[model samples]
Target: MKSLQLLLGLSRGQHGVSQSLAIDGVWGATSSNALASFRQGMGIAEQGLLAPADVTLDALRAGLPDGVPAALLWAVMINGSAARIEAFHQPLLAALERYGIDTPLRIAHFLAQVAHESGCLRYTEEIANGQAYEGRKDLGNLQPGDGVRFKGRGLIQLTGRANYRAYGQHCQRDFEADDPAQVSHEPALAVDVAGWFWWRNGLNEWADQDDLRQVTRRINGGYNGLDDRAFYLARARWLLRG
Candidate 1:
């Protein structure tokens, strides 16, 4: 029943219609009306049955574009700028494909984290000054200004001098030595760093198991802003699922 509601919601979203069902596992007038509307839109005969046929469900799933759609990205990042959405769209898709975040579940998890960490794609760098990290050897903030120099950047907020050096090495760019700020400045690099972190942490395995808590812990090093993360996760799942 929830699956039906999700499909209906997806159909509505794809058509630029903002109406959405609650996706609860209960049959009600709203669900009936949504189903009827969907059938009408698809040029199918409307039926009074609460449960739709397998063929109808298959039809609904058919032709869903591979990877996340821009409409869905806008939906998930509700407060995000349209220009930013346009800017990140192709870069995000490329990163997803390159990192093998191709499955619906993986995409959901990845987008949810990105949405939260980036504040719906608004922030590329951490807002706070990096003074607290001045002597944090764990992050390899080994120099006098290492903390302020490599605080956090990129979509997933990659932090620390060590991390910058390592990711720079991976990309063959001197992020640490030359300019660490480029991680957030370059759209493709901003998204790619997140993909690299995802792959490095083996997050796909946890996403495959649908373990949101574990994924959050891995990404955040704890459960900060956990509810917001879950909210985005639910939204991404609804938007991405067939």
Candidate 2:
């Protein structure tokens, strides 16, 4: 299948294979050799055939390019949906690149916070009703329904009318006035907003310092879910290590 071939091709360098396998969805000798090489590297039996239920597919999914592997994401967020993982793959990568989360430490810290905030990319918008934030002048919910209209959305849960307006202004998208829900509806926007928040708050500096507590404080304004955030941070660091 094309998926297997693509994984194998992406993994060639890591597995000590030089030949490129055509990702044409064909089962051929070249593909077989590549798979065998990958299997040998993984300490698995060098079976030429690609089995439907083989663990090799999972291993190959973690191969290279090394931003945030889907396999590692799945591992860290054990309850994450595979469909969501697949959908947010490219968007998350792009957001990280755009926001200068280029190193393993930065990516790990960023992902740890977002993972804790978004429940491992499961819920983009906050589950609770926005009534609690009603009439909260600090959050710029001055109007009758500004709270519900601009409830927290995105991976980092961009909340409040002021925050939305700020992000909309930066991106030239009027999310505060029109289409506020689009932040949660679009994967790219959801992830990008997190990147925007990270960049604006200079959390990457704290991340670079390896100060998990400061990073949490910067994003969360407190130590809420500090334990869970630390758990994800450790997992990401281990998985993202080169």
Candidate 3:
């Protein structure tokens, strides 16, 4: 419950938290309803009861979309020190702001993606090299769907060889798909790559559509058939409203 509260950024005394969760079908007064809602939110089976291995802190910290990456999650799991993960994220927040993605929804979603991708900095080794530069730099692949290397990188997980070629054109860098080292090694390049993907992909357009789920699916792929999409949308709605 405490972790959920933090994930939702809700205060303990806040009544609207329940309302918000209930309204979005994330939580319910009835156990069955609550379980169904959570499952629906996560695009999983709604068992109507919290499973022993449910999201809890570990799962939430490492699942995809909003969950943290496996590496950083492991660190937290072993050390029980989430502070290290938090510390690595400070710069990422600034990077998002610097790239012109200022909305709270965009920021939160961006953070969520980053948390899932970079292991919240738990995988610094990935950054130091280009192996994980899939979406880290502004350099793109040859073109959309180009079968090259070092594709989508950074927070967006930009993949495919063509993506890297295109990113290179946008950033005016002669990027090589085989050389992810260049992309991941430099944080500036990584953030720029992510920003460029966000701008180039239908993300900006969907964001303008004012449909949170639509935008999230557009950015993260329509995985889970947009089941967890509602949560992303709900968060976006709140952030946009603010």
Give a tens-digit lDDT track for model 2, residues 1-242: 65566566667678766668764667888887888888888887637566766777557656645656665566556556678888888898898899999999998899889889999899889998888888989989898988888899999989889989999999999985588999999999999999999999998899999999999998888999999999898877766772
List TM-scores for all candidates, in order: 0.77, 0.75, 0.46
Ten-residue region with minimum lDDT total, candidate 2: 71-80
Q: lDDT order of candidates, best first?
A: 2, 1, 3
RMSD of each: 6.4, 6.6, 12.1
- Candidate 2: misplaced stretches above 4 Å? 1-65
Model 1 agreement with the true structure over 29-90: per-residue lDDT tens digits: 88878777766666767477544454555556673555677756777676677688889999
Judge candidate 1 at residue 153 and give its lDDT: 89
- Candidate closest to the true structure, highest TM-score: 1
Reference-based lDDT, each prediction: 0.82, 0.82, 0.47
Model 1 lowest lDDT segment of ten = 49-58
